[model samples]
Target chain A: MTADILLQAVIGGLLMGLIYALVAAGLSLIFGLMDVVNFAHGELLMVAMFATFSLWQLTGLDPLMVLPLVVVLMFALGVAIYHGLIARALTVQFNRGMVQIFVTFGLGIFIRGLAQFFYGGEFRSITGGMVANRTVQMAGIYVPLPQFAASLVCLGAFALLLVISRTEFGRALEATREDRDAVALIGINRDHIFAIGWGLGAATVGIAGVMLATFYYVSPNVGANFATIAYVTVALGGFGSLGGALVAGLLIGEIEALTALVLEPSLKQVGMFVVYLAVVLFRPRGLFGRL
Target chain B: MEAIPDNAITRRRRNELRCALAVLVVLAILPLPISDVYTQNLIILTLFYAGLSQAWNILGGTCGQISLGHAFYFGVGAYTSTMLFTHLGIPPTLGMFAGGAMGGLMALLIGWPCFRLSGHYYVIATFVVGEIGSLLFLNWDWIGGASGLYIPFHGESWINLQFRTAKLPWHYLFLTFAAATWLVAWLIDGSRWGFAWRAVRDDVVAARSLGVSVFRSKMAAAVISGFFTGLGGALYGQFVGYIDPDSMMTGSLSVLISLPAVLGGVGTLWGPVVGAAILIPVRELSSTFLGGSGRGVDLMLYGAMIVLVALARPQGLVSLLALVRGGRNARTA
Candidate 1:
């Protein structure tokens, strides 16, 4: 029985971890390239989830079906945020770093507050999601169908990201991050790359939102719930590496779930935070992050 | 010619002191006419934040290490005194110092490891530390768990730091803290420690080459900043008479604490106070305008303000004053 429980916990953790990895990828990409940590990344995720929820509620469509629509809308958000806030923050001369932090932090507050104002602070979910209620029984372990589907979608998204990152455009984007002046000398506009990076970052969260909406509740404050974990995942995975984020996310989820079973359920966050602090202290570069 | 420059420097210092004193004096008298509890409450909040921002400025402003998690120290202070009062019947005046020490310990725990990470990465480390703190507090039932601890209303006494009826005492108490914090920051701004911090801020490699222990200096600044922030938290606990992990030391509170220094001016003594002055009023007006329970609009406004300020005016509100003063000086010359 104990073995079965542990197995389930591990599986559950992996499932949740995939979404977390996907979530952190967006943040990592933006921070890696632009040097602007969008404190509003999670908020954008929340908005995308809300959009997914709204789409389902209105059109009575499946969560997966709404992915393309949500992705487009989220891309617009990412681009808009870049043009509107991130671009300006990057160019500002004095204390540009501090200014960038405030810009994003403020944007976070603004989005969260607006979400609450419009949505009324209540948690809502897609009750009619295609697969949430159904569970598959495999060798005495139950895997919820919605979670399974979400995991599959998350895998697909990660693979797509891999494909995108290896393309000629991806190389150019990377070149911009490596050396802006060097890239510009080679006739590449870093500004456009940064905007695209931000857009991709926001869109990554949008995809996470779609998968998440299938199984998790969405609310204005929901962004806060996921943000810390995403940050921990990104930091642990070593800042700029997508694969590292995926591995770290799974590890964290497993740790959280296993700790809950071994010690106490309430201390799940405590366990993760301890690990996060320790990792940051020991390896500031993170698992795969460039020093 | 050398004596003339010295005389001019002294005169400028004197003028600055005079301006600071004039502002404080005006603040002290202005509370007299405001008899309403709400207005007094606003003054108390403004001053409390003013103090909190100054405390943040010590590390964030001077040392160039942006701590997004000073709320951890604030929570430590609030919990220390309140816990002592709730469990052992100790008054907050004595407990406040204890709280400060506890906050220092907390800072040490966070700063020791986090000093390795520079810039926004360090900020992220602070956030994680704060998360751990609140989570621990949330689980520990002895501190009242998630429901949080409440300080019972005792009769009015200066020693206990308890005042039941009027907001005047609370206003002045916070005012003293705000003023004292400013004084501390001013002193630090002039002291060797402040120089060390600025040295680190400008260039860590250069500062290290100059034989300065960048780690030790940053750590010292963090400890002092944490201690003062804890003291401020102690005052906030006494005045509010209630505390919770979320309200006292969570992520939101951390953002609120950092905003003042960021918006006001980090290194400048007057910048934080001025930022608090502007924000507190804006906070009150927005909440009122939105009709008591307007969800998210106030936050949106604050967000808009931060973004606008950061993008257009990274120098903070104090820079505007400097510009005006420079213009005046130019015209006079």
Candidate 2:
């Protein structure tokens, strides 16, 4: 492959990886605190994307401008779902792992179905004039403006989450993660904290989703595809480590993008999984995963 | 009553024989009476899933190792047999056995390193194996890459099991396979090895303390599980006459085998049968109308069922049914 093409792919992959980190960081947050792997996390992002799509359609609001509304709505939805179904089920005698997986998976499907029913299956994009189409040329490599914006947003969110986790509330979240029972003995309302964590996680992905929609097409099945990638990223980063998730997400994006330059675009996913499996074999705890 | 002991024993034996006869009769009559193409297709699909799920149950349901990547074996089996038949002119019937051998061997390769980890690690390893298979199949130009491969059509061939007739032959073949799977599952459940498996699943450390070869037991489970799943792949390829990477290796297909068993009752004889009965029809109906919309309708419904069942009744409907039957038996006794 030509140096320019390879360099472009690496940059593209790195940008995609940042977005993956954003999505996966939310997954890490929810999974870390509640021990619930939300299969519908991607669907939450899909919903956010659709929300932005609708707002852009009706009020002509830009996707970036609609981020706050998307985050709030998704956060509320996540909290509601956690309280309504998940919390109660965790107390019961059952296969919590598979059951939660299915529950979230079901929610994902339902959301996707609703999206299809309301919006149809046509690919939807929230494009706004020259910025949407504009690309910067650096050393013979083209970088789309939207992608660059998404990367910036991703990094910004990561920093904000880092700050939140270090605060008192964030410490409670850490305590919640270390031991749910111990967290309760210390007078913390674990359930409420968990709900908040889940909400934040969902809301974070909501921002990622809108950014994704800006760069690519929005469809019902898009969430499922991205969810699998998110799962791969989570596993690669170590399940509950946010920093690990970010690093793993970026790594996957870079690998996929770089591979796509030399190999068929579809085979890029193959490359992503190859790296994931290799990580699992050699370093099961992930790059920054706790032993 | 004391004077008629011989007669009582004979009567009990006769009753057992009658129940067996009735089951045979039902299985025989199912395909013949159903003429509707959709209904027949659904039944055949159910039987195919029943067999596949039963095979999956050995590892996932029985051993409590939830593997979402059983399709690795399934894909390997499909590609191996299809390739053999098309390229080397080997009969698919023979190729199927060879395919199963390959799958079983591959399981041994992966299972050795994976089974050492306690919980969820095995699940992750299995998922990786499946992804690897999918990747290799998708990228390797030898297997047509992402474009996929198609088996040549046949008018009538005993060797190929290809026919231009109705779905009757395929239906019978799959049904026979399902019954064989049930029989094998029952045998394993009752065998000494089955007890060892239960011990390992319940507590590996305890089983090891008791001198059970936990590693060997799990490997055996994986091998057997992979063998039958491979058989499923062979059957799937021949029936559809086309094998693509996505259809063969996707998580959705893996769900077809595992979800039913999970819903029915893992580690139980009738789990696959029950799961197939409930899920196959629903899946068919959903795919018929709602599948093409690219919406998550089918998946949502399927996931809801799994979650509800897992939370409300982890033992599944089969176990519940067994409990009812068991109560009646106790009362009679």
Candidate 3:
């Protein structure tokens, strides 16, 4: 029975870890592309979730059906943010780093406020969605169908990202990441690449948001908690490394699950934090992060 | 590189001291005429945040380490003093010092490992550490847990730092606190340690090559910054008369502590005071007028202002003072 319970936790953790990997990938992509860490990355996820919720409410469509629309909307938002705020922030003469941090932070607060203004602070969940309240039995362990599907979708998204890396646009992105200024010498518009990078980052997170909306609760404050986890994942995975994000996400998810079983459920996050601190102290650059 | 003459530096320091003293005097008298509790409360909050922001500036601005987890120290300070008073029958006035010491200790502990990481890694580590702290506190039942601790009424007393019927006392107390922080900053501005800190902040590699101990410099700044922030937290706990994990240690509180310094002019002596002076009033008034309905209009306005200021005045609002002085003294007014 104990072995069964442990096995169940491991499966559950891996499923959740996949979703975390997707979220962290978006952040890692943006950071890798430009040394800018998007403080508002989670808010983008929140917006996507809300978009999915709103669409479902309006048209009676399944969250799966609304995923494409939400992804497109989030992509537009990501581009708009780059041109409207980040572009200007990058040009500031003094306190460039501080300015970038606050600009994105302020944008996040503004987004959260806007969400609260429109939707109040109540927690809303999709009640009768396609995967609602369903469980799959596998070898004496029960897995929630919604989470299982979300993990699969996230893995597929990761594959798509890998596929994109072989395309012309991906080459431009890699070259830009290598040396943004040098890429300009080769006729690559750095600004245009940055905007597209932001869009791609947002779209990836949007995919995760739509999947999460199928199972998770939707609220104005939901993003804050997930954002914290994403930060930990990114740092632990080594910032800007997609593979690092995946491995670290799974590790964190497993640690969290085991901690919940050994300690109280409320203290589950402590395990992940402790592990992150330990790893960071030993290897300052994280496991896979490049200098 | 031409070195600034000793007399010129001394003259600037003296001028700053005189201006600061004059401003304090004016503030000390300004609250006297306003008998209204609301305005007095606003002034008190502004002064309190001014002090807190100044404390944050020590490490965040002067030392060039951006910690998004200061709420950890604040919460630690609050919990330490509150627990001392409630369980051990100690007066908060003395307990506050203990809280400050604990705050410093915590900073050293956190900084020991975190100082190795630079830039975003360091920032995220601080943030995560803070979250860990708040979560742990929330679950721990010994110090009242999520329900929080309420200070019992012991009537009005200077020793206890509690006053039920007087806004005037709180205003003066906070003013004194803010003045103390400002005084400390002024002293640090000309000290040898200050120059070393600035060097480390500007470029660690260069500073190290120049024989400056980067790790020790950051640790020292962290200890001092944590001490003051924790002290401010203890005072805030007393003022509010209640303490909880959410109230004392949330991520938003950490951001709020840093915002004033960021907005006014990071690393400048007067930046926190000016930023708090403008920010607290706007925050209080907007929340009272627009946020009462909970429609989040006040938050929207607040966020928008931060974005606008950060974008428009990257050097901070204090630089505007330089601009107004004909732009002759641009870097440090």
Candidate 4:
């Protein structure tokens, strides 16, 4: 019975870890492309979740059906952000780094305000969706269908991201990351590549958001919690490393699950934080970070 | 960078000191006519943030360490004093310094490990550490946990730092606090440590190569910054007469403490004062009018202003003063 309970926790952790990986992947992609950490990344996730909620509420479509639309919407948002605020922030002659941090941070607060203005801070969940309130029992372990399906979809998104990384656009992105100025010399429009990278990053997170909306509660402040976790994952995996994000995400997931079992569930995040601090303190550049 | 003559630096410092004294004198009398509690409260808050932001500027601005987790120190100061006052029968006036000491010690503790990482890594680490702190505080039942600790009103007394009938005392108290922080900044501005810190901010590698101990410089800045921030937090707890994890240690509070310094101009002595003067008033007024129903219009406006300021004047609002004076070059005050 003890072994069964442990197996159940492991499976639950892995499933959640897959979704965490997708979220961190989006962050890692943008950071790798341009040394900018999107402080507003979580708000983008909140927007996607809210979009899913609104679409389902309006058209009676399941979250799965609305995934594509939400992805497109988020992609546009990502590009618009890059063009509107980030572009100007990059040109500042004084305090360039501080400018970028505050600009994105301010954007995040603005987005959160918009969410609260519209949604009224109430926690809303999609009820009666395809995966809601269902559980799959396999090999004497039980898993919620919403989480299981979300993990599967997140895994597929990871595969898609991997595939994209192997394409021509991917080569352009790699070259830009290597040297932004050098890429411009090679006939690549650095600005265009940056915008597309933001879009791709947004789209990946959008997929995760839509899946999470199937099970998780949605609210104005919901993104803050997830954003912290995403930051930890990225930092632990070593910033800008996709493979590192995957491994770190899974590791964090298992740690969280085990911590919950051993300690109080309310302190689950404490375990992940401790592990992150330990790893970063020893390595100084994270487990897999190059810079 | 060309080295300025010693007399010129000394003259600038003297001018700055005179200017600061003049401003304080004007501020001291400006509040006498206003007896309305609302406006008085606003002035006090503005002064409080001015002080808090100055503390943030010491490390974040001068030393070039952008800490998003200062709420930890702020919370530490608040909790330390409150617990001492409530549980041990200790007066908060003394407890305040104790809080400041703890805050500085905590900064050293956190800085010990965090100083190893730089750039985005350090920023995130501070942030996570803050969250860990608040979370732990939220669960620790000994300190009242999430229910929060409420200071029992022990009537009006300067020793206790509590007042019931008038807001005037708090205003002057906070004004003095703000001026004290400004004075410290002024002293640091003229000191060798000031040059060392700016060097670290501009380029750590070059600073180290120049025989400046980069780690010690950052750690020193952190201690001083955390100490003043903690002092401010103790004052805040006494003024509010209540303390909670959400109110004292949230991520938003951390952002609030740093925003003024960022907006006014990081590393500038006058930046926090000017930024807080503008930001705290606008924030308070907007929230009073628009945040009543919790629609978040106030938040939206505040966020928009930050974005606008950061994008339009990256050097800070202080530089705009230089522009108005038509100075070809602005000295780093």
For each candidate, the alpha-carbon lDDT, in order, equals 0.86, 0.81, 0.92, 0.92
Over A188-209, each residue of candidate 2 has an lDDT whose tens digit, in order, gives 9989998898789988898899
- The digit string of per-residue lDDT tens for model 1 on A1-291 reads 478888999999888888888999898888888677778888988999999998998899888899999999898889898888788888877888888878887898899888888887888988886686789998889999888887888889889989998999999988988888799898898888888898899999999998888888999889887888888888888877888888888888888888888777777877777887788778887888886
Could you give candidate 2's per-residue lDDT for residues B1-333 as a string of tens digits?
448676775675556457545755687788897889888889889989989999999987667677878898998898889999899989888988888887787778878867765454456567766877787788888988888899997567768979666888888888877887777777677567888898988888898999989989999989989888888898889888889888999776776678788788778777788888898888788878777766656655665666666667766778787789899999999
> Per-candidate RMSD vs. true structure?
1.8, 4.3, 1.7, 1.9
Q: Which structure among the candidates has the greatest DockQ? A: 4
lDDT of residue B261 for candidate 2:
85
TM-score of chain A of each: 0.97, 0.96, 0.98, 0.98
Using DockQ as the yardstick, the better of models 1 and 4 is 4
| Clash list (residue pairs), candidate 1 | A113-B296, A238-A289
Q: Which ten residues in a row have the lowest lDDT in candidate 2 chain B?
A: B12-21
Clashing pairs in 4: none
The deviation in Å at residue A154 for candidate 2 is: 1.2
Task: Spell out the clash pairs found in candidate 2.
Answer: none
Segments in model 1 whose C-alpha atoms lie over 4 Å from true places: B1-11, B291-294
Residue A236 displacement (Å), model 3: 0.3
Tell me the native contact fraction for each prediction: 0.86, 0.46, 0.72, 0.78
